[model samples]
Each structure stands twice: as structure tokens, then as C-alpha cells.
Target: MGATVEVEGLTKSFGSQNIWRDVTLTLPPGEITALLGPSGTGKSVFLKTVMGLLNPEEGSVKIDGVDIVSATDRETQELRKRFGVLFQDGALFGSMSIYDNVAFPLHEHTDLSASEIKRKVGEKLELVGLTGTETKLPGEVSGGMRKRVGLARSLVLDPDIILCDEPDSGLDPVRTAYIAQLLVDVNTETDATILVVTHDTNLARTLPDNLGMLFRRELVMFGPREAMLTTDEPAVTQFIHGSPVGPIGMSEEKDATPHHLLGAMDHLKLGDVPPQIQPSEGMGERAGAVRHAERLRTTPDIEELVIRQPDKELERRPVTRPAAYSAPMRGLRQVGSLFALALDVIVNIFRRPFQWRETLEQFWFIASVSILPAALVAVPFGAVIALQLGTLTVQIGAQSFTGAASVLAVIQQASPIVTALAIAGAGGAAICADLGARTIREEIDAMKVLGVSPVQRLVVPRVLATMLVAVLLNGMVSVVGVIGGYVFNVLVQDGTPGAYLASFTALAQIEDLIVGEIKAVIFGFIAGVVAAYRGLNPSAGPKGVGDAVNQSVVITFLLLFFMNFVITTLYLQVIPAKGA
Candidate 1:
């Protein structure tokens, strides 16, 4: 099935800054088109917008005569099914096996039974030349293999159009050639239109039927692959030849050339005519002929392209596993990895167990970093709860209940949530940032190759440390907030400290403290794990590390809040709020 995708005058901006403007292109059916751009040129943003992952401020993208930009949510989803995407990082779910990863879309969108899903997943894996590796995790595979898995996943749905974003990044030349060849083969076999976003000039020039480049947030050129690539145009020549001296400049400097300068970027002329591609009709041709004969019955004009003879079509010089792991080895590796991680965690926990140095460090950070918000919000909040409780106590002529109310509020709700958030921002972001830096420097990769489990060496220690510190921080928050509440009671409500302390102890149950401590431990472990996961998967460079830190805090805060509600609900239902 062929598909034609059109992006008409697409535009998007953030605040006062325009990301891209008036971007227009038409991708013909049954062909591969390349989208090329430098770093930070909004390549990803444009792709996301095309996929309806982001809404453009202006214009529309139509797929096979359907305008996705104007579509409703359901319509957009339906449109998305027509196109499959392979993200740069593979983006496989870390928690699933290879088979399940490839089978995810089918499971979610189809009514296929277990047997059918398994069969289909196995078939796709075989197509990708990854048969017999069903049980492997993505982390266990090389980068090239992961990309194949990603490609397999994308093809499982038999999508009419495929969108690949930076599919050749981080891969060797041989792997890049293989991937390009695979795409060409698939395009021929399925007659599916494909769009690839990339920066590799050779890969781009050699692989696609059409080419386009984004410069200055606009399409610098777009045309037949041969026409665009083998050109004397200064800009196109400079880019295709990988030259630093060109119309483009480093650090945002623009050549004030006239806008209407036609072919300003084209600098070189075509010197040689490449040869044409023709697949061999070998003894194996009998099978293809038989298939072609069969296909002719259903539809005529089934021209068979010999898989091997496509040099001209291939844009010149380009062109171009495993087994069930042994059960014992797998188990031993997993267990040893876990144990080593546990040992490292234990060592880190006891390494500074004087309870003064690291504990004080945590205390100072939690207090200093978090005190501003805590003081601003908690003090006023305490005052409100106190005044409300005090008014009720006075009306009932049982003024001592004000202390009971303050104690319950702080012990049950305020301290745990406040402390978790504080730790999430301070300790969690710090860990995420640090680990992210290590990941960028390839330290984690080095450890992995050296037979060290990153999870044990890195994750276990950080999680254990966080949980240990959180236990103490939760206790401290409770005590400090309670004292602040009593001070608030005395200064604001004129209640005596002795009566306040006495009433607080009388009404506060041990269960409250136990619940608070349990919540802290859970939150701390979750925060640490989340921070480490995000950091370990940090983006390609420095900005990616910052993003990891940012995402870690956000996701940690969300998870902490969610867990708080869940635990609170369970506590109320099962524990009965201490003799309620």
C-alpha cells in the first residue's frame, strides 16, 4: 500500500521564540524521503508535530488525504496507526522481553490471542534476522541489534508509512549500510512510503529516493535524491561533501545572501552517471517467479525488482541472533548481579553510619533547600488549622484539643509529604544529575562491559542511602513541624506549651509515627530508583543530562504523591487511624 504525506505551511513557536516557520513538504507515495538538519534545528520537534504528538500553531499535515492536524483525538490515533516510528534510542520498554516488546502494538490494538501474538512476534523477529532471541532484554543487546528490534516492532503493524528519526546515529558504517538496505528492501516488499530524519550525509544521500534539509528553520532544498545530492549548488555541495566552509556557519552567524538567490547552496556539478540496479534471477528466482505468478492472479503489474541490482537506485557507493540464553548462566548472572548490587548498597549504607556526617549533610540540605517553601506554606497552613481547631475547642470548652489537632495534622500528613518533596528536589535531583553525568562519560557502559551490574553498583547504593536518610528526615520534619505548630499555638492562640505537649502525647498514637516512617522508606526507595533510571537513560549530551535531572524530579514528585494517596487509603482502611 502506498501513502502520500503532506505538510503544508507548518509553524510552531514557544512564547516569543519561533521554533520553525512555514515548513512545507510533500512526501510521495511508495518512496523514502530524508529529512536532514543540524543539531537543535527542531528536527525532533517537527517530526513530533507531524505525528500529532505536538500541535502546530499553524498549518496541517495530511496523510493519504486525511488532515491529521485538524483531527480529533480519536482521529489522530487512527492516523498514527498508518505510520510507524523508530525513535533514535530504540525506546524499548526495559521491563519487557524482546518478544513482548515487538508484540506490544498488536496486544494493545488487536484481539490476537496469546498463541497468535507469539507467532506474529516470532515472524517479525525472523524478518529482522533476530530469530531465537525472544527472551533477551534490550539492555543485553548491542546498539545495532536494538535498532533491528525497533525496526521489527515498527513493522509488526504493517504500517503504510514508516518514520525513522536518527536511525543511523551511534551505529558503525556496516550497520548503517545494513539498516539502509533493510529499509529499501522493506519499501520494495511492502510498497510503504518511508521518511527518515538524519544527519549522516552519506547515509541520507545513498538511501533515500528524495532529500530535504532544514536550515534556518526552513527547507533549504528538497527534490529528487540524485538532483539534490549530486549538485553544484554551493549549500548542497558543501553539506553533501561535509565541508565546514559553506553558506552555513557555526554559532548562529548567517551569510546575508539574498533570499531569492536560486541555487545559492548548490556548488558542484554531477561528473558521473551511476549504474542501474537489477535483482538477479537465480535458481531461487523460481520461488520469486512462482510468488509473482501467484501475485499476478490477485493484481497485475507485479514487477519484481532483483534484490541485488540497485546501485543506481541505491545512490552509488552505499548499499548493503541468537539463541535462548543458557538457563543456568542467565540465572547465575542475574543473581550474581543482584547480590553484588546488594553488597555495594550495604557497604555504602554502613560506610558513613556515624549518623552525624552524611545524616547532617542530608539534614542541612533538606532544611536549607526546603525551608523556604515549608516556612511560607506550612506556617500559614499550621496557623489556619490551629485557629480552626482552637475555635472549635473554645466552643466545646475543651481548648486542649487544639494540641491534639496539630499533632495529628503534622504526624499523619504534613511531615511525610513535605519531606518527600524536599528530598525529591534536593537529594533526588542531585543523584540524577550526578549519575547522568557518569552515564554521559560512558562510566556506566564501562562497568557493564567489565561484567559489573550497573544496577547493583549504582542503583542499590543510592536507593539504600536515600531510604536511610529519608527515615531520619521524616522524623526530623515531624518533630520540627510539631514544635513550630506549638509555637504557633502559643503565639497565635495563647495556648500554654505544657498543656500543648501533654494533649499532643495523649491523643497521638504510635500508629501515626509508624505509618509516616513506612511512607518515607517507600518514597525514598522510589525516588532513588526513579532518579537513577532517568539519569542512566539521559539524553545524548549535556542538555540531555539536565533534562534527566529535571524529568527525575518531576516524575519522582508525581510518583511520591501517587504513592502517598495509595498508602494513605490503605492505612485508613486497614489500620483504622489508631483505635478510631
Candidate 2:
């Protein structure tokens, strides 16, 4: 049997835009409830809030006496195991195959053997009628197939509560009916408490045993399916019957026209209420229906029991303008939050159960992909320094100092700065884009729901890998830079090769190389952290991802230049070299 979800006095908003307020509902055990609402009514937001993905401002969501809203991270994680969420658009990791995506939760959260995981995944896939398509990626599949994959993934964990957000979206009528039947079959077999947020009138009219509607920022009614079906409430009737003559207007608000009122009455006079579609005959009685049967045997008339209760009245208040300090305060809070996230990563980076595979992959990507750009920048920078310094030294008749000047600049500044820029520009942007995509797709949330820390699984590995590759790439850039200087001095400037090589190490100290390496490592860490932060907390949608990537690049550049100044100053003061 599934657990009940009780939401009381729940309020949520994004800045000044209130999505819903004082929302109260009870999802009974083993019953399927459909939350119906027009677009922009916050149905999806309500689902996310119930799943603990977004915290309501002033209320509690309790499941089995545990208030998830105020629960600690560990407690909330445990609670999330009982939830199976099918996000709109599937939200599957684009990189993974269908089988791997479905099996991700089990692999991350359980110690099941490979064979067991395979069997369970195969079984769930078969249950969703997605057998033999396990090798396809999410991008390769049709929208309906992706939704089925999402459904299969959600069910693989045998969750107590299944939350589906617009499961029928972007599907044909036949596919929608097939998915509806699949939901019914799953509910019958598992008896999971299912809450589906949808706008499909057909699905809302037929699939769920109970129905609730959200309109004008509040839940209008919630009760047995029969009670809703038999109601003459203007909004509910207009919505369920797909009529345009009642409360819902073109702008999704109550119509204010007397003509609209007359049209609604005329439509009502036609007596055109459609019959509720019954469950298929051969499926036998659903477990949910059986559970309801036991309740009905004692209550006798559950529909009337629900109808007599007053609809929840939400007290509307004037929307208050935000305080003058709200923007600055929000910025400060974000800074603090990012600092804490970085601190968490540092504290847990050395903990046991390392993500070695992900770390290796990141290392390979950074080291290989970033090499050419680093070299390209370093070589030109070194040649320019050599050309200018050689000309100046010759004019002053101190040609021998050309080697020392070029070598020192390449080792102390050019190599580290160039490699850092390359890594931040190339490697850092890649990290940001990847994490941003994952964030937008809700894959990061899925990982959290599966009790996986994205910091450990993704961020730490990338940070460490970038740092490690930065140090190595610095060395490569340094060598190529020195060679570029050598070529410029000996060939282009007509400088003596013997003097160039001889004076190269004359004033260049070992301390310079050490400081350069340190700077490269530090810059790489800063780049990785900034990129991960921007990526993991993107605003929303494709535009958000683009903005995050831009912010990461800009932030990384600022931090790199500022930190370079600080580190360079410290090295110069500490070291006793001639040009440090």
C-alpha cells in the first residue's frame, strides 16, 4: 500500500509572482488523483512542491507524519525514495541509453547486482511496452516513447507515490489513450498513490478516481470523480466539457461579460455532459478501485460526503511590492550560498567512495581538448614578447638580456595566464554548458531524488580534473612558449642562438616555475567552481543555459585576472629573484 500526502496551507511564489497560495489537499493512499488546471495555473509547480523539489513558502507537505518541507537533507532524501516523478519531456539524460537511464536510480541508490539491475530494468521496460528499444538514446526516440521511458524509469523504483507532469503532452490521441491505459495498468498492479498534473480533458475525465482543478491561482474543487463529473459548477463544467463560454477566458481568467454568461447558460441548456469513460473490461478490478470499494462499503455514499464539505476558500490578499533591499539581499544570499556549495565540495572531495570514472573522463576531456587552444595562445604571446623585448634590448645594446626577459615573461606570466584563459574559455564553458543542460533537463534533480550528490558525482570530478589538467597544460604551454621565444629571437630577430640559450636560465629561477604552476592550478579551480555554480543553478530553459555559460565565462575571467594579480604580487615579495 502507498502512503498518503497531506499538503496544508502551502504557498509558493517566484519573486512577486505568486503561483499558488494556501493550497490544501490530501492524496489518499492507493488512489489516483488528477490535478486539472489551465495553462499557467501552476499545476506543474504544485507537483514539484509536493515532491520536495521546490519548498513552499509557508506550509507543510507531510507523508507518513514526516514533514518533507522542513526535513533535513538526509531526511528529505530518504523521503524522496518513495516518490517516482515523470517530468514533462521525460528529463532523461541525453548521453545515456534508454536502458541506462531507466536503471540509473537503482544503480546509484541500491547495491543490487548487475544481473538484478538488468532484470529489473528489462521488466520495467517491458511493462511500459518499450522492450527491444533499450539501446536508443532519449534524443533518438519519439516524444511519446520518451514519455514512456520516463514512466518506466519512474516505476523501476517501485515508488509509493508516482507524480506525472503532463504525461500526455505532445502526443497523438492514440498514444495518449495507450499511455492512459498503461497508467491504469500500473495503478492496478502496484496500488501506488498516483497524482497526475494534466490539461487533457479526456484523461482527466476518465483515468483518475479522484479529480482536482486549479483555476485563477487556487484549487477550485477536489473530490471523487463522480462528484466532479456530476457537478454544474461553471468553471469545472466549462473546463471538463472543453467549452469556452464560462469562467475561463482567453487570458485564462474568469470572463466578465454578460454575453459570456448567456452563452454558458445556453450551452448548459443543451444538456451536453459526456459520460465518464469506464475502465477496460478485461483488466479486471483495479487495486485502487478495490481499495475504494472497501471505503464505500462502510461510508455508503462517499460522493455526498465529499460534496457536503465546503470548497477550500483561499483568502486573497493584495500583492505586496518587494522591499527596497530585496535585490541586494538576494544577491548577498546567492553569494553566500555559492560559497557554502564550494565549501561542501572541498570538505567531501577527499571522502571515501570516490567517483573515479567520472574524474577520469573529465581529465581526458580537459587535457586533450584544451591543449590546442592553450598552445595557440601561448605561442603567439611568447613570440610578441620576444619580438618587442629583443628590439628594445638591441636598441639599448643589452642584447644578451633579451633571452632572460623573454624566458622570464613566458615562465612567470604568459604560460600560466594563457593556459588559464584557454581552460576557462574552452574547458570551463564545456562544463557550464553540460551542467546547465542537465539542470534545465531536471537530471540533476533526478540524481538528488535517487540520493546521489551532484557535487560528488559531477562537480568534484570536474574541478579536480580541470586543476590536474591545468597544471600539466601549463607545463606544455611553458615549453611551447619558450620555443616560440627561441625561434623569434634566433631566426626572426637575428639573435645569436648560443646567447639566447645561454641567457635563458641566467636570471630565471626555479621559484618562477613553481609560482606559475601554483597559479595555473588555482585558476583552474576557480574556473571549475564558477562554471559548476552557474551551470547547476541555471534560471530555466535554453535561454537560461546560454546565460549561465556567458556568466561562467565572464566570472571566470574576472576571478582569474584578480587572483593572478594577488598571487603574482605575493610571489614577487616572497621570492628574491632578479625579475620575480
Candidate 3:
């Protein structure tokens, strides 16, 4: 049986643009409910909010008895498994064949064998009329076929809830009708609760057991199909007739000047509400309808608004805008978010099915781009330190001490800082840009809807790679800088060669090198996490991605230097320098 969904007092806004407000609706279990909205009313956003992909400012989305908005990550993820989503345009992976696409959830969640997986995939494909098209890629199929394929994928898990966003978007009238009937067949067979977001008039009139319409940011009306279609509401009348006259807020025009703008809407009655679609042969009576019939006996006169109160009162407080955070509070919130994400990554690292391949790939990429820069920076940096210290020591009649000073500066400060900056500028920026691109493209949301945590699947491996590569790069920088300083002091500054080598070990302890490596690890982790965070939260456009990349680099640099100061201070205090 389908899970009952209760959404109450829901409000969502992005920046200053309010999409919808106080949206309260109940989807009867094992039924089809259509949410109709004009193009920009955030029809799709509502679906995502209910799925917990987007958080509403003031409301609760309770699936069965669990509220997704307040659920823990583990709890939220568990709840998501019960939902199957068919995104508009299919949202299929371009690289995978249809067979693999439908089989993704099975691969992610279940322990089924290859043959059993194949049989299940076949059954779902056959049900959707795509059985022989399994081997074909999504690109090879037409738009209507892609939608059917998406439908098939949604059913593979036999989910208790299904969400369809604009499934009739690009289809012709015949194709749309066929898909509408197909939905009825699916409802009858699976008995899964389904919510579809679309603005197709024909589909609204015929397909769903219940209907709701969104106009000018509010749900004008919602109830059994008959209640919505036979209404005299201007918005409903104008919408059903596809009339341009008397737009949602123009009720005055109907009374003052009704002839031309109003069209034939006044003369034409909606006749009779179309009979609800029935299941095809072999699929029994719709379970939701039987339940709906029984519910109508006591249903509060469907005439007034708020026809059915859900399981409980959703809001304990009056709806209001979420409190705005001041700059300092916002900063604290960001810090807390980053810390939480870091903890999530740490916990996920120990879980099975680790992302070793992705980690290794990122490691190699970071290493390749960083080695030359690390060496280049180290050589110039160490040479300058050596020359400056040599000149000072010679003037003070203590030229032998120049090597010790330069080595300490290079290993204790220069090596790890240089390695970290290189990683941030090269590899960290790349990670940020990659994630920003994915974020803007809705790919990350797609992964979230599919029950794949972007943090676990993508961030964990990348962060580990950054840390590992940072450690290696720090060692390379330390060695290269020491050699560069030695060569510069002996050859350019005309310092004694044996004195330079001996003096390095005199003042520098083993712990100095170990601490530098430790700093590298911390720096790498911070850089990777910062980059990943920025990448995952870029603004909504190409320009936004570019800005996030810049922000990641800037943030990583600030954090790296601050951490460097603290670590250097602590290391000096804890581990005494070698004394003569």
C-alpha cells in the first residue's frame, strides 16, 4: 500500500522570489493527485520539497508519521528509499544503457544476484513497453520513449510513493493521453501513492482522482476531480477554457466589460465533469478509489475549502518568514555547517563500499598538477632565505649558523604552507569548479533524489585524495627547499658546504619535519572540504560557479594561513627545538 503524505503550512522562497506559500495538501494513499500550476509557480519545487531535496522555510512534510524536514541524515535517507521520482525530461544518465539506468537503485541498495537483477529489470521494462530497448542509450530514444523509460525506472524499486514532475511536457495530445492512461494503469497495478506536477488541462480533467490548481502563488482549489472542474471560480474557469481574458486577479473585468475578453466562457457550461479514468484490463479496481469512496461518506462538505484535514494539525505557530540572521550569526551558521559536513565525511569514511577508485584518481590528478609548482616555489623560496640569512650571519661573524636558520624556516614554515597553497590554487579550485558545475546543472539534486549522498559518494574520496597528496607534496617541498638552500649558500653566497649541512641538523629536530607533515594533512583536509562545500553550494548560474571557485580558493588560503600560525605556535611550545 502507498504511504500517506501530509504537507501543511509549507512555504518556500529563494532569495526574495516567493514561489508558493502556506501550501497545505494531503495526498490520499494509493491514489493519483495532480498538482497544476502555471510555468513559474514552482510546481517542480513542491515535489522536491516534499522529497526533502529542498527545505521549506515554515512547514512539515510528514511521510507516514515521520517528518522529513527534521529527520537526521540517516533517517532522511531511509525515508527517501520509499520514494521513486521521475524527473521532467527523464533525467537519465547519458552514458548508461536503459538496462543499467533502471538497475541503478538495485545496484545501490539491494544485494540481489546478477540473474535476479536482470529478471526484475526485464519485468519493469516490459511493464513500461520498453522491453527490447534496454540495450539502447537514452540519447537513442525519442522524448516520449524517454518518459516511458523514466516511468519504468521509477517502478523498479516498487516504491510506496512516486513523484512525477511534468511527464507530459513535450508530448503531442495523443502521446499525452496515452501517458495519462499509462499512469492509471500503474496506479491500479502497484497501488503506490502518486503525485504529479503538470499544467496540461486535458490531463488534469481526466487522469487524476483528485485535482489542485496553483495560480498567482496560491493553490486556488483542491478536492475530488468533480469539485475542481465544475467550479465557477474565475481562475478555474479561465484555465479550463484556456482563456486569456480575466486573468487570475481580474475579476472586475467580468462584471464591467465581459463580452470580448471573457470569450464564450459565460455561455459554455463545463457540462459534466469527465468520468475518472479506470484501470486497464487485468488491473483490478483502483485501490485508492475504493478508499476515496468510503472516505466521501464522512468527508466535510467538499464545498468549503480545506476539504480533508490530514492526520493532524501541522502548524503549532502562525506562519511567518524565517528569522533573518545577522552577519555574525550567518557566519556562525556557516561554520557549524562546515563542521557538520566534516563530521559526516569522517563518519562515512569508515563505512563499507569505499570510493577507493575515485580517491586514487583524484590523488593522481592533484599530484600531477602540484609537483612542478611545489618544486618551483620551494626552490625560489629557500634560495631567498639562504641568501638573506647568509648575509646577516657573515656580518655578525657567525656564517656557519646561516644554514640552521634557513633550514628551520624552510621545514617549519615554508614547506607545508607552500604545499597547501599549491593544492588550494590548483587542485582545490578544480574540485570547487567541478562541484559548482554539477550543482548548477541539477546533477547533485538528481543524486540526492536517487538516495545517493553527494558527501559520501563524491566528497569523501576527494577529501582523502587531497590529504594524501598534500602529505606527499609537503615532503617533496621540504627536500627540494633544503637542497635548493644548500646549493644557494655554498655556490652563490660562498658559504662553507660542510658547515651548511652540519648546522641544519644542529638546530632542527625530527619533530620539526613530522609537524610539517601533520600541518600538510590538516591543510589538505581543510582545502578539500572548503572547495567541496563551495562547489556544492554555488549560485544558480555559470557566473555563480565561477564565483564559488574564486571563493573556495580565497577561503582555503585564509584558513590555511590561520591554521599554520596556530600549529606552528603549538609545535614550538610542545616540542623544544634542538639545542647546542
TM-score versus the correct structure, for each prediction: 0.56, 0.92, 0.86
For candidate 1, the 10 contiguous residues with the lowest summed lDDT are 302-311
Per TM-score, the best of the predicted structures is 2
Error of 3 at 156 (Å): 1.2
All models, RMSD in angstroms: 16.3, 2.9, 4.7
Model 1, CA-based lDDT: 0.70
The sequence of per-residue lDDT tens digits that candidate 3 reaches over residues 446-534 is 67877898888889998999999899999999889999999999999888998998897778888998999999999999999999999
**In candidate 1, what are the lDDT values of residues 408-518, reduced to their tens digit?**
888788887877777788778878887787777545642332223456545666676778767877787777777777887898889987888788766778988999999
Per-residue accuracy of model 2 over 1-580 as CA lDDT, tens digit each: 7889998877788877778777778888888899987789899889888988897778899998899999998899899999998999898989899999999998878899999999999999987789999999999999889989998999998898999999999888998888888788777777899999888988988788888988776677787776677776667777887876777777844554333475545555324335544446686778787776566677766664352223433234644434522788778877887888789789779876898998999999988779988888888988999999999999999999898989899988898789778888999999999999999988998777767788988999999999998898889989999999999888999999999988977889888899989998898888889899999989989999999999999889988989989998998887888643
Residue 5 lDDT, candidate 2, scale 0-100: 94
Worst 10 residues of 2 by lDDT: 307-316
- Judged by lDDT, which candidate is best? 2
Q: By lDDT, rank the candidates, best first.
A: 2, 3, 1
Deviation in angstroms for 106 in model 3?
1.1
Model 3, stretches more than 4 Å misplaced? Answer: 14-18, 89-98, 125-150, 170-178, 248-284, 289-319, 324-328, 487-499
- Provide the global lDDT of candidate 3 against the true structure: 0.83
